[model samples]
Target: MGTNQVEMCPVARLIFVVYLLVTTCSASPPNFVLLFADDLGFGDLGCYGHPTSITPNLDRLAADGLRFTDFYCTSPVCSPSRASLLTGRYQTRSGVYPGVFYPGSRGGLPLNETTIAEVLKPLGYATAAMGKWHLGLGQNGMYLPTRQGFDHFLGVPYSHDMGPCQNLTCFPPDIKCFGHCDQDVVTIPLMYDDIIKQQPVDFLDLERAYSDFATDFITMSAKKKQPFFLYYPSHHTHYPQFAGPGAAGWSRRGPFGDSLLEFDSTVGNLLSTLENTGVLNNTLILFTADNGPELMRMSRGGNAGLLKCGKGTTYEGGMREPAIAYWPGIITPGVTHELASTLDILPTFAKLAGAKLPMVQLDGVDMTDILVNQGPSKREAMMFYPTDPSVRYGMFALRLGKYKAHFYTRGAGHSETTPDHDCHIISILTPHDPPLLFDLESDPSENYPLSLQGRPDLQALLQKIQAVREKFEATMEFGESQIDKGIDPNLEPCCTPQCTPKPSCCQCD
Candidate 1:
């Protein structure tokens, strides 16, 4: 009887192993919906502690998933941050440094760099990028999103403010425009795939258009039973704020708040679509910003809460962003102080989809454990790069554990009419000899500095940080700056049915 039972156990184990393999092979990979906001602040949503900016959808997302308190972007600006987010590497490595790409810029994100879309596409994921492809549009639309592994691309090449009408009166009349708002810059074009769908896009209609396009893609993907990766980088919360009719007068915080509410509604719409398609439980959604608020806009910009300074600076407010991760039946609902960044998105997603990573070295670490089992983050340190053109390579600041050391300090300049009169004072770059160290756990605002005069332990911490920086600098190879390339008018997109003039043919409905 004992010999018979032992033989039966081996057969049972073999059957069980086969069942496990079949179950794993039959289960579909989760769909990825990444919602990235442009110039959104840490305190913009109700879940992040904002009192007035009503974000019920985002608040509910936080309540159902993991909310990160110390999430950051690699850079404080648009193009560089987006580059790092997509490639999972520093902007310097990708050649998209110094500044953002203009419409006429001949260069763009280099072809060698592997994007998140490129990584996921080979694994049978239908990839689409909707809204704000500020990466670049090189000669003959070579560097556009469609050329870079995205199956479908619908959006503008750059910021809406970078157009012929910088200060469009279409925005709320109370908000003031800084800089040369009257300059006759090139008109912004809205693209569908590689073709120009509209020139001088109607800013008021953008939210609806983007939401519709996204829902359609999601529904189509669901019906086809194909896992999809939707990268929705919204143009809202940036300058030249324009809210749709429904959200125009909805906020007490003025146009910025109104535009934010409109963005919140867009998020709500996407959530509803996922549920309607019966893919809500199998989808993993990430909501975050490219960078911090544009405080130079004053009341027209976003609130960074208690953090210091704002966009274009290496301050906490400029780099730290509001990040929420929602995956029903997967991630536990809670807030984590563990440090993470946009860089982690690529490797994390790759791991989840069972896809192979790029061959080249990557700056981002896989954060799957942090999202799944609530384990400690693999990322222990973060480096902050400067947007200033002159100061290229190496980081302006380094955050190791709870301690953050700022090797250089500066603030974004504001216009003369800006109520914050001391902005100019903060704009001047100052180098710290010993590096200004602050305990971010205690002072997330970075208001007070720790003295390195007496404490040996603190001094040792600085030396350790310097060593890490030095090691990184010694091994890192900087890529040529694509953004610094000369601009060419011919590279700009122009719709068909040409107008009378040559360059002015860019105008279309």
Candidate 2:
């Protein structure tokens, strides 16, 4: 049998054994709450060292959970990043490149593919997804949340700023585009079984609003002692900023900071809910963002600090994000510098729940040890590809231990200024360049590239990138099998902005 076919060692098994051995007690699967923020950058939170940002709630989360110093989202953009998260696989493998799904776009998550929700639903867990579900939209393809296993979903089908605005600026003084942008003000219109029960959720009051819903959910489930998965996705900090109720005049950082306040309060609310429900000690809470901040417009985002590149680039800023996991009685409060990816969540959750994952090809390994056991890091390298440009889609990135290699094709009009440097068009309309190598450990900022003259090892790593690229090309050229095998037949065709209809849909059975 191939290595891919081998059953991965269950990290949950070790957790269960340890629990029984230490406490002399069997364990019950804890309720899972995934608090996902939209386009939240690495330095946006107070824990990550944002000087002016006040995220007391999230800071508290770090104080109580395992704070990950080197964590990355699978994709750098919103939709594809989210797709990778939902399926626990690289978006590229699933043909979910970058770019938001516009109205009438036929693509969504492939129906046949299993999602985190799908994997958990069968175990008697009520799975719900709230806030930005930007996977895809429309009929005749697989983008709707229902097809992907989310029992309840709310918020915009795509980014609040995806479509054209009333005016050039994302913020509204103009009512025409603003009204369209706020279409979801009345419950982002129901598709499938999911519906936004409430409409016009105040952005500033989001933490309270969503928390109320999630708290109710937890309380209801707790009353019945039922295990449930509540996926809380936030729309704050994305664009078209709305300040939280108490945060209206709070920050000097403008609307961006206001959004951050809402996010902080949201986490605080969840934590409070867990504590009040008597599940704080048992419930496992994972907090992370879809991708790095949007820095092209400084008025909208904060710096990735020393990290090179900001949203929409292959640089660390685009993919690297703030991540922390907490289960008061389970995870020790401290920092882990090991590299971890959002993709690992699926397998990790399965292992923790004592559930066997269905036969499926997953690009992510379960990082249960990193979470529970004080074991060495399991993820040595990660492959990154941003299929979307406007948001994030690095052509290719591979992290081998501390050394990371990035291979990107600079297409036309790539120039965009950022806080640290003047981003300009490079290698435009040309063949890809030699890979850029960086020692992430020595230089977390990725400011200096290792000189090739003294580095044969670096050259070998670049060669590895070339080899990986060749294989990827072969898969695309030969029309490899699609990733999602069980997509709803009624779901639409998921594709990128410059997508060409392939002979077969991007489905993998």
Candidate 3:
């Protein structure tokens, strides 16, 4: 027999066994833990090169995983970005084309859509949401975390600052006083299911509150043999920075730095918990922020450098975020200059868990390979829309490769009736307009833009961005007629008679 034929003997069985081992090694399911920081900037983390900032835990986490340098949030603000994340679709598709929603806001993830929890739940994964829930709080028996997909929900229904507040203090009036403001500031305790547990005596240092809840969720899930998903969206370093007692000493950088220190400690605590639980090796931890920092706090906040514009505007700072993916055994550590987005999380997690998605349109792409293999991002284009005219100040932007095009109009009232006025004057909005193209390979800060006057490559990039903008607009279901009628009245206010707060919209006892 030839040598090739001779391999069919018992010795060949040894080779087959080795092949099986290798294949099995490649097919393991990973536990996913997403740590979403609220309104943290691109330069907030130490790994991102923030000077004098203390984010050791995050820095170490970045070292352990692949840090994505060009990651973008689907939207610049919290509610819209989160809506995109949970649905893996643009928030506009779900009617969240606006600001953060409240119990009475007529907006939320549509019932037809499937959340990561809903997708993974059927596949034997224990899913839980442990922090902020900015999606609508359905008008009575219609919308709630448990109804959405999460088996457990513990934390604020919206932004931590959303609850009844006086002078920006998050304290809700005391229930004992029948909603009277007798006591100083009534500490708004966190809500678990329907009960208010410990009142957060002072948000000036509420970082520990978020961390403690996340730790509890981790420990609880670790005890179960099944894979688990923890969506820990922290209320930290957003605004009105509350520096915890442990970080009170760092008040020199103002409340902002104090909040930063507290955030670092919280991340460190979670990592330590994973280590102690012995599941650190198998868990996939994702760290990112909702959007850029509040620009008004620049003196108190970090910088985004030449990327242009800050929060409340459709600039890089408003949309770009610091992202790190750490799964010790699965992902190799390095800097990935890929263009990724927050919307990819839902589908990515679903693919990892072998979960089936309900038939529906999704905007996020499955980037599991990019996460595992590493290198240049597979995504070629990214688009953003400030649906809410108020928050974004009437702007829309799209980025294709290196070229970014944005249109800005003055808010509310202005007419082209006068010679100096034009009906929605469409000038190149940004200082770096006329579609300035940056060779990101050479310019990381985006300070220098190569002249596009003679550059066909840049022109093509601009055209590509325009195409993306068109596609985005075509996909959007705008106008009052497209609104869902079944959504709770509180979520979608109605002028029809006999409309009271819907049952599902009210907090349950």
Candidate 4:
């Protein structure tokens, strides 16, 4: 038979070639699991250099793959940031820009906007979103995860803290106050698909449940030989930082650290599940945060490392996040300071899965070359937006190469040491009649501002900003992000066939 193999002739060789092609074409696509955390800072994990939080699994994952020192979220807040992350479009362009869409708000990410799930669905990936769904809960049934292309959904409709116990009047709430935590005070509905699984799930029970859901989903997909995409927007390291039972005070960092520990454990468990299922090698896992730390809570809030300020600001500490990508043998293990953002997740995944890209303008680019080949990313410059998109007072930064220009600065999103705000932001504008510039490479802190009087670099930066601004305004007609208007709160859709129950707490976090 061995001798006959060579003697079989040209037709046999052609048949073998065709067999190889068919086998390769029908091979399973890489399974994707996006572990996105809420309010996690730039220096919150052991892999990212936090002294107190020991995240061994994440650290090992980083060691086994790639870690990014300068990844960013599109918005400083949750809803808009999540929208940008899912669509790969700037939050402003997504029209979800006025701010987060509240529970009663009729606004949602327009169905026209393509999410990573929608892109992968046509390619046969079984997609599920297992945690926070802050984009929209429109009554028109237009904005829920079920409508957004996710095959399965579990977790809250929005932030765990948007409960009835909201600290609306007393933000940076008092320790004694239950604010967004006490189930009696406020309860974010924990849903399984569109039906309410639990109207008021104990906040402490979330991380463990999400991990269980994710692990089971992975196992089921593996058994079926189907590719899976798990978009888990974790509810840890966020406000009312409640650790699950037996997890409190597990770390020296206090309750926040305890919460982080729980999240870390889940990561370890998920990886083990992947390995046990024999899919670890072919899976593409990404870990990142929605935005930076919430600095109002002091020690309870996360540390943003050397980056200044924290959440709700356009500053580095607010938008810049710690990012890691892992695949057993595919991605080269290393670290890079390349500028990347959550906006790139959609495009990069689509590129890897052989899925079709949305026809709209996308702010994110494929970083597959950077992830696997250790090659430079095509991302050249990144545009930073104001903390409040409603008022364009110019508190923004535009990065070109190694230089960044500050078009505006204010006292609102100041350093951690800054006091609790009282409904008014004290403007501390950095001179921008002709914006201030900073060489982020030399001065990562933005301590010294460069004069833009007659420098070529300044002219180049301004020209770049102008070009970006033009494009930003091109789609400014505001498509479906009318989150504040047309809110009937009556048309909400669900999975229980014609379900139309209005969501309870759609308020902002």
Q: Against the true structure, whose lDDT is highest?
A: 1
Measured with C-alpha atoms, the lDDT of residue 26 in candidate 4 is 69
Instruction: Report the lDDT tens digits of candidate 3 across residue range 295-373.
Output: 6554444455445444544557667889998877566667776678988888788766667765888777778767664
For each candidate, what is the lDDT? 0.81, 0.65, 0.62, 0.73
TM-score for each model: 0.91, 0.80, 0.77, 0.85
Tens-digit per-residue lDDT, 242-351, candidate 2: 65456654776777887777677777777787788787776889999887776755666555766766666667887798998987757767788777888888888887
Worst 10 residues of 1 by lDDT: 1-10
| Predicted candidate 4 versus true structure: per-residue lDDT over 386-445, tens digit per residue | 645643443377776677776765544423454433111444545465666777767765
Q: Is candidate 2 or candidate 3 better by lDDT?
A: 2
List all candidate RMSDs to the true structure: 6.9, 8.5, 9.2, 8.3
RMSD of 3: 9.2
- Which portions of model 2 show Cα errors greater than 4 Å? 1-16, 20-27, 140-142, 163-207, 388-395, 409-415, 419-422, 425-434, 460-509
Residue 220 alpha-carbon offset, candidate 3, angstroms: 2.6
**TM-score of structure candidate 2:** 0.80
Best by TM-score: 1
- Runs in model 4 lying further than 4 Å from the true structure: 1-24, 165-186, 390-395, 413-424, 428-431, 453-477, 486-509
- Which ranking of candidates, highest TM-score first? 1, 4, 2, 3
Report the candidate with higher TM-score, 1 versus 4.
Answer: 1
- Backbone clashes in candidate 1 total 0
